[model samples]
Target: MVTKSDTNSVQVEIVPSRFLMPETAQRLLCEIYKNGGIRRIMIHGPNMPREVPYGPGKGIPIEANRNLLVEIGDQAIELRVKVGRIRLEMESEDYLGGLKAACERALPFSFQFRQGKFFHDRMTTSDYAKYGKVEDERILGLIDPKAKKDKLAILSEDMVTFKEDEER
Candidate 1:
């Protein structure tokens, strides 16, 4: 029963107050380097600060990442966040397939899951993170949540991580 307008439903996190304008993300880029190598990068100018109090449906573009889309609407800007990153952690490309199923289980959705499929042994790490499962902060849980939070490393970076593979 989802409609086009419903598809526009998005999560909003207002900064609560102030906005942080890093002079440049170059410092963050430099910290990632394991090797002492200096490289060149083409960085665009800083974004103009949107002094408007941030509330729901308010955001200015910062940098591009996976699943990011910028579209100009007749009245307001239409920013589309594709479901790409959401599926990446589950090793699944089927966005609506798995997530919708999770939503059905965790929240209010009219659907039923089939046997042997609702729980994936292959993705046990995210099995609990999927549906009807909440992580207890009391327990030191989750091996690597940060890994899933980030997109693939951009080769455009000035440096790279040199790991020693077993074969080496």
Candidate 2:
């Protein structure tokens, strides 16, 4: 439910030829965020569960191989997807060229970038129920803007560690 500060944002959709590995996605995210002008980034992909859902291994806690620790500027973000499609909300169309170049540099495989609105810009029913009808559109579509804590982890640079024994 991430939104941009500016209403005139263009969504830069980057779809890879194949599902990206965690390392590749991490590298690409770091590169994109470092360039700035990117207001929000939404990654879309198949869900990866933290535990085995069925069979002999049902209910067993397991490491999701696709989960990655990506360093974006000073922020250490945990990517929860295998990274099928990345939708970036940019402040202006002026950053398109630089964004393209950055993507090209980070992604070795084939990918595509397009400019369009990929998400709902207005408030939804669930949003209203969760946070009420707030005047700020930035917090409109979000679930809980006033919450003291966020569900996502914001790790420090030194905490960018991964379990090597985890199955891939």
- lDDT per prediction? 0.24, 0.64
Q: Per-residue lDDT tens digits of candidate 1, residues 1-168?
A: 843422222211111111212311222222212222222111122223323237664664444422222221111211222111111112222332543433333322232322112111233455346422433321112223233322112222232322121000
lDDT of 1 at 67: 26
Which one wins on TM-score? 2
Residue 96 lDDT in candidate 1: 29
Task: Summarize candidate 2's per-residue lDDT along 1-168 as a digit string, tens digits.
Answer: 975554566777889888987778877877787666866556667757677879998988766543467655665556555679887767788888988888898899889888876656677776666656666454332233333223322212233222232211
Q: Scored by Cα lDDT, where does model 2 land?
A: 0.64
Q: How do all models score by TM-score?
A: 0.14, 0.72
Q: Can you list the residue pairs that collide in candidate 1? A: none
Local distance difference test, candidate 1: 0.24
Query: What is the C-alpha RMSD, rounded to one decimal, of candidate 2?
Result: 7.3
